[model samples]
Target chain A: MADKVLIYSRFPKTMMTRFAEAFELLDTAGKPAHEVFPAEELAGVRAVLTAGGTPLGGAEMDRFPKLGAIVCYGTGYDGVDLKAAAARNIAVGHSPGANAASVADIAMTLMLAATRRILVADQYVRSGDWAASRQSPMMRPQAGMPSRRIGVYGMGEIGRKIAARCAAFESEVGYFSRSRHDLPYQYFPTLEAMADWCSVLMVAVRASAETNHVVNADILKRVGADGFIVNISRGSVIDEAALVAALTDGTIAGAGLDVYAREPHVPDALTALPNVVLSPHIGGHTLDSHVAMQNCVLANLTALFDGKPLPHDVRPEGKTA
Target chain B: MADKVLIYSRFPKTMMTRFAEAFELLDTAGKPAHEVFPAEELAGVRAVLTAGGTPLGGAEMDRFPKLGAIVCYGTGYDGVDLKAAAARNIAVGHSPGANAASVADIAMTLMLAATRRILVADQYVRSGDWAASRQSPMMRPQAGMPSRRIGVYGMGEIGRKIAARCAAFESEVGYFSRSRHDLPYQYFPTLEAMADWCSVLMVAVRASAETNHVVNADILKRVGADGFIVNISRGSVIDEAALVAALTDGTIAGAGLDVYAREPHVPDALTALPNVVLSPHIGGHTLDSHVAMQNCVLANLTALFDGKPLPHDVRPEGKTA
Candidate 1:
């Protein structure tokens, strides 16, 4: 019999068909694998294909006695129980740096839309207000991007790309990272210092327990009344409640958000506020990025089935191969 | 007596106050001088402060026998009867290059919004469709900026700036202009060829009789089904009927328009389309650009009143100082 592999997430049909050629693929997407598959059905499963959202834990792994590898389709495998997998001697693999360009594009898109009042402008035209008033009330005379300071909270691949695009618009780019990379952008050791120095604060850090709520009320206050904040990273990287309060009280000028603390459940407070631009969490969810991620997953699974080291191994300490 | 100047358009209160410091200001912003001013009241008018929308024709010029100069507040004096002014020995001045940066910024904003389906995404989140569907239908897997060809219809200051920004996004920039400019971007002498070569065609040419309807059905068809068009220049530069037809018939993929053939009157057909992003003619109406334009207008008026040559003299043959 062909080697059995459990598919824990939905992939493109073409990719799934390609995988099916080499293994007996069992799909359990959008439902618990334990609930979807009986013990006997999962007994021969030696590999699993998953995503950042549908992670495999010890309980799920214990059901599959022959499981040897867990390959995640995209970056950020935070949902996976890495310690549990490590103790069980199961290898973990995930795609990294696969969606940086799309995320950076969305980051800049949010910034420009929020700063330029695109949503308001579109409404002004659509509502026939422009014809009646003969002027755009959406014009905030002080709003512009040129020569403004843009503070990035992280200087990883996505952050660096965002900074590069901002530079082309004549913005002064600065950043706060754990350790200074050899980048030409001005470096700040603390988020507060960067917020104080910038007119636009961009949150682009990876989400984790240590980085959770990095942009709290203090950072918002430092960003101040004329400042704008944009978050394209994971929602956990920012304190959403504090951000909403700051926006409500005018601690900051405005915001552009692509992620929320409880996604698809944006607070009524944020939805009711006119000073924020809200989007569903779609920063890295582009067709090109999806294809890259699928390719990475296939490569990892292929390498594992051949008894070779996984191409993008993830460890318990948050390190990637 | 301070030389009397007739204000034909509404300027910012601050700008008008500054002009008041130098001249005996007569405000007729929304009304005709004939309706607002009696014959006696118009007798001493030695200059006219107008916008492109308010033309100074022979009849208006005859009313003010002492009129020596027509100072326009912004660029695009196509509406002003330059021959009539020149024949009467009345010099013409306008603010040139004042709003280039702002217009360039908006051009990029529209491009990103249309290509990335920002307006639709915003609507998706706002209408709770994202929450219900849990995924965006706006994701076109092949959509991106990297390695794409951006064909600029004009190589003016704003066009060059737009190209610079597109370059930072890794787009290949090309242009179609009447004559070659001293730039590194590929130049096509014909619009049809450029449209064929580009995935995104940008309209940035100035409005004039010869340039009217430059981007018609032929060019749109050449751009094909996978292409997008962005216009930040005058609405007359395009054939609106052909564009609407093409957009309706799917001859082109999408469009981002900031200007319309008729001011304040967008066709229901254009507004009803889903693949286009529409905005009012506020591309260069930012506060920074307004201030710059006002400053330029003031400098030009001051020079004309001081008996010095106009700083930005717009002649009948489309030449400027």
Candidate 2:
């Protein structure tokens, strides 16, 4: 008998199908693979390979009597019940550092778009008012440059990359991290301080319980009316209600967000603000990034099937059981 | 009697009024300064300072019997007919090198805004479609770093500044010029070649008969569907008709224009496109740029008042007239 594998991601099936031909592949895309055990369908399964959305808990693990390992197919393993897997003596492997560059690129794009008012210009041209309104006083304000101070709320790989990019434009790059590093730029002691100092604040931190609501009403107010905020890390990083209120009340200049509090669901307040630039959670969805992440998944999948210790394993703990 | 000065630029009167505390200022923002020489407002004038739109043409120069100097209160001298002024021994001074940094800043802002689809996402948020389309496919396209080729059409001060900003994003920068100089990036032999090589092109060349229609249909076609064009220099630098056709046919992806072939007039075809981004030719209009340009005008005015030779003069002849 061949080793069984499960996949749960928005990857091209052709790539996975080719890999499956070489092994006992059980794909779960449109429908859960019957041969592979989904949490609810877990029965006599030896191992599992899943995405961020599939929640594997203690209840499901009980069904897989002989399960030894679970492989997360992406960089984040937020949905996995790691503690339950650890208690059952099952190892969990995950891919890391694969989509950092792509995520960084998205962050910069959002920042540039929001700061420069690209969409506003588009409307001006498309509405047939550009020529007649060219000399209008309303047109005069469009002729300016980006703000001086730039703030990054996270000092992770993506945040660091964005900082380096901002430096190229001669923008004063400042960052808020767990512990300040000796970077070429300034490092604020706290996120609120960073917001206070910078005119453009970008959130590149992760989405976790401890880090939730890091950018709330108080922080947004500190950012002030002349400032801008961008969140590329996670939707939970910012309180959406506070952000909308700030934008509505002119507490801050504008915002650029790639992720929201809920996936595939955006709040009406954020959607109603002309100042905010919002993109679906796509900070890590570039072609280059997708290919990189998929390759990492393949590497881990190949390692697990060979019955050897995985290169990137998550010691399951403190997850929803 | 105090020397008479005619102000032709539509600047905020408050600023001019403050500066005029030292001079016999004749305000002509809305109406002609003097009805006696309506056509030649500079007639019997010691110095003349005109804004961005007022063109001092050949026929008008013949009437300025007492005009000692003409001062362009902005960097672009296209509005002033230098050769005509020179023929009559009238010195014309312009504010060159004044707005280089500001113009460069706006050019980069436009590039970043267009490439990242910033404005489009903003509309998405403002239209109350966030929840239904939070994870829409359009939003996902900009999730990571953009790895696209960028081209600069001019290699002057503004062009170089744009190049510096482009390199900051790790974008491959290439350029075209009348005569290529040594630079870190690649230099294409022709505009078509540059277009072929880049997914985004910035037109930063001066608008002269030589540069008119430089970006024709062939160049647009070379730019292809994946490419975009940005013009921060002059409108005539691009062939507007060809551009309209290219956009309509999808020969190029889109454009971000700050200048139009006709001042204060945009073409219907160009205006109808949703992809295009337009601003009312305010690329070099900034607070810093205005101060620098005004200082240049002041220099020319002072030179005329003192009967000294004018600096930054534009003599239209191949040689100084």
Candidate 3:
């Protein structure tokens, strides 16, 4: 018997059909993706594929009696309740290394935007105020600073990629991670050390119970008034309130944020700051990444039907790899 | 006797004093710097210090009889007449590496702004038409495309730096120069070949008599409708007419430009296009670069006085080492 796959989010019709052509697809259409999971839609579904807005929780897993697995379409699995899925003996898998390059590209994009003041300069040019702005004593530095030190909070694929780009600018790169890896640059013993060493800090770690609020008030203070921050990882990685306070008081230079604590609904404080550059949580929403991620889903589905080990299974709290 | 250095362009008091402290400075305070040479102000001047703006053509050089060397406070030496300097045995020097990193940083900035549709998105967001504008069909793939091939047109200092940063995105890099070097990536024989291999192309080559309009109508057309172009080197390297035509017809994807055919002035054709990102020719304008270039000027002064080989001498065709 064919493995039945249920797509739980709104996706491109062409791509959905590409997956459906290979599986016994169970249709679940026009259901507001982010609305709480419908009980009726879970009836007899063997597996579900979802991402971002369509979060799958504990109670929803209980509805599917014969559900063997859940596949997240992207890297971040925060929306999916991994612990609950584990308790139900349901496998949870994600598309790791799928959008690694895409996320890395955006991370560098944000870093460059923050460092070079692209938005400010572009605004000056568009407003027909380039000449006036140049003459205006109000303008600080139109060009980016040279020879800055860059600090990376995570040493994963995306973080390392950002580090590589930073190093190309001849910036000294120092990183903080759980375990030390052999890198071209030095590794700091702690995030505080990393923060103290750099005027530009980039946070690219995972968001979990163990890592939430890793960049807090104390760390923000350590970054100081001369430093800038860029959060491309998760909104929870940074203490948003602390960020707001620091930004308002001019305790930190500026920030470029791709994610937020409450995304698609940013705080008024952040949006009001002239120094900050904010984007909706669409960093990984590139055509290249979407296609790559969907292909990963195909591989995971193929493996499940073949009774083989899934490629990127998220183990339970203490389960063996 | 202390070597007398003439200060031409106006600078901050502190910066002027700082330069003076390094050498015996001639303060052309009341009189216009241009009038100084033919007038009594040229009496004891041994060296001249000027920014990139001061015109030091053949006629101007005829008046500075005792001038042994000139230190350009910026990278480009367009205002200096090469033939006149060579004829009179007056060494002409410029700051090269001083601005490489700065230019590379802003080059990448324009690339990101153009590629990610930042300017357009900003306009869309601020107009309160976010919903309508975003929902409108765009030719762009998405926020950022990943794993696509990237091409660099001159593999010199700034170009190589841009390439190194591009590598961080896991972009397969291909480059075109007069001759291939032993770089980490493949080398394309021509610009057309490079464009054929890449979805994004960056023009970081020199602009000169031979290289003028190298990226003309044919090359732009060859790059195709799905490719993007970034020019940070010199505006003359690209055919402005061809670029305008391409952008108008959508023969190429998009463009990010720093230099222009007529600078301090931009063409309405480019500004009118929603797909282009434009910046004034300030790619190498940074505090660090300014200081570094000043130091290069000092080096040129020292070398000329001590009868040593001047570093970074501008050639007949304007290439520097």
Candidate 4:
């Protein structure tokens, strides 16, 4: 008999096909598992597969006394309630750095799109502005990437990839992380110091309660009126209200955002601005990243079924945000 | 006394302020010099400063008997009639490689934008489609940058920079140029072979009469339905009609174009498609690139007036394109 694994989050049925082949899936379909499955079925569930963002606390974990593992679909596992999982001795697993390259690719994409004003240029040609010989301040020449300073807020897998790409463009790279790693980029003691020094502040920091709204009015101001902010990490890292104000009043030149304070519902004030290049939260949404992450999930689940430690278990201190 | 430099093309007065300070003012404002100025003034013209695309043939050159030099503002001097300049013993100068980095940056921008479907994702967020959980085939995962084959169609300054950036992303790099250079990337003997081998074909070949429409329907077909075409070189290099058909019929996946076959007047057919990310020939239009190009122009003009060789002169064999 296949080991029963509860699908705790809502995903398109297609994404669940692989897990269904290996295990008996009791899909809650984004509802409370107890509501979908009776007490007898819940007691037999040995594991849970979920999106990293969905909140799974101690109360939920207790529903399945035999639950030995929790496997996150992507790199992030912020809402897993690490303490609760630890107290109940649930081995947590995640696909670390599986989506880093894709996330970094979007970071570069957003940075170039915002800094080069490609979106504005696109409209300029489309709206007959260029043909009419119409002039706008927006068409003014922009500085190139060479020798520009790029400050990364975090120095994890995604940040390192971003830094490497910046370096290849001949831009100076700097970063501020929890602790300085022995990397080629210059280390800053604080995000403010790095923000002041670099013209393009790239937020790749892992999000936490402590990091909520870390990139506020002060950081935006420090980035200077000519600077830009590119955030690919998480939405809560920035104070969206402050970002809106900064963009409105020219505290910063532009922004390229993938994440938002509220998922799927970005404030209208942001969408109204021309300087921003906004994208839905799909940073790690790539074919290769998905396959890699799925492999990790499968590996973790197989290990748990075999009574072995997860090959890609998340450490308590290094929980993915 | 200031040297006489007849401004041959239309430019806003602000852009001419710097040139006006160094040269005797005879602003034609894009009109023919003979129409704007008397024969006596035209005879005294020592140099001509014009855009590289405006036609400057033997007939035009014959009017300026005293013209010592033809200096191009930006790269591509295709309109200068290089043969005519050589026949007249005129020194031709341009800002060689001054904007290579910027052009390469745009190539990367277009590649990422088109491949990752950033614009689609942006629309998804802005239109509340994401909130409604709308489904799109485009929202399907994309392959990450790592190990992806990137074939550069030209191995010039711009192509070299693009290859280096792609390498940093851990992408496999290949190229096909007229003459092979000592580079780390794999070189193909022909464009077709490279196009078939690479998933992303970056068009950076210099535009010339012989190279016009080099990337035709056949080339587009070889790029395959899953591949992309990024052209930052010149509009003349690709068959715009074939490109339109290919894009419409899904002969190729997508394209990122900076230049079109016609200036400022793109066919409505091309603009109607959602697969392309279009820009109006703004590849080298950056503040830093402009400043660098201007310095080269200044050096070329000053050298001509001082009875010295043009420092940034275009050799007969190495005309800017």
Which candidate number would show the highest lDDT if scored against the true structure?
4
Which residue ranges in model 3 land beyond 4 Å of their true spot?
A: A1-6, A9-17, A23-41, A52-54, A131-133, A136-146, A305-309, A316-321, B1-17, B22-38, B42-46, B52-55, B121-146, B302-309, B315-321
Q: Lowest summed lDDT over 10 consecutive residues: which window, candidate 4 chain B? A: B312-321
Which ten-residue region of model 2 chain A has the weakest summed lDDT? A135-144
Best-to-worst ranking by lDDT:
4, 1, 3, 2
TM-score-superior candidate, 2 or 4:
4
- Per-residue lDDT value at A211 in model 1: 88
Candidate 3 lDDT over B244-273, as tens digits, reads 999889998788888877655567777788
Model 2, position B56: C-alpha lDDT score: 71
lDDT of 1 by residue, A38-57 (tens): 98889888888886655567
Task: Please tell me which model should have the higher DockQ, number 1 or number 3.
Answer: 1
| TM-score between candidate 4 and the true structure | 0.96
TM-score of each: 0.93, 0.85, 0.88, 0.96
**What docking grade applies to model 1?**
medium
**lDDT tens readout by residue for model 3, A1-321:** 567777776555666777888887765553642254455545557788876435678776767777888888888777778778878878878888778777776776777776666676665565667644355332344335356788898898778878877776678888999989999888988998988888888998877768889899889889888789998788888999999999899888888887887654567677677677666555676888888888888887888777776787766357642
Residue B24, candidate 2: Cα error in Å is: 4.9
* lDDT of candidate 2 over B1-321, digit per residue (tens): 477777766666755754596667776764555453465445556777775446677776555577778787766677777678777777888888788877776676666556555556555655555545334444444322247788999898888878877786667899989888889989998888898899888998877758878899988999989788899888878899999888888898778888888866788777776667676666666666777777877777777888888776765447553
Off by over 4 Å in 2: A1-75, A79-97, A134-147, A309-321, B1-5, B9-42, B51-55, B124-130, B133-146, B306-321
- Model 1 chain B poorest ten-residue lDDT run: B133-142
For candidate 4, write residues A243-297 as lDDT tens digits.
9999999999999999998887899899888899998878988888888888999
Worst 10-residue lDDT window, candidate 3 chain B: B131-140
Relative to the true structure, candidate 2 has a C-alpha RMSD (angstroms) of 4.3
Q: Give the fraction of native contacts in model 3.
A: 0.44
lDDT of 2 at A244: 85
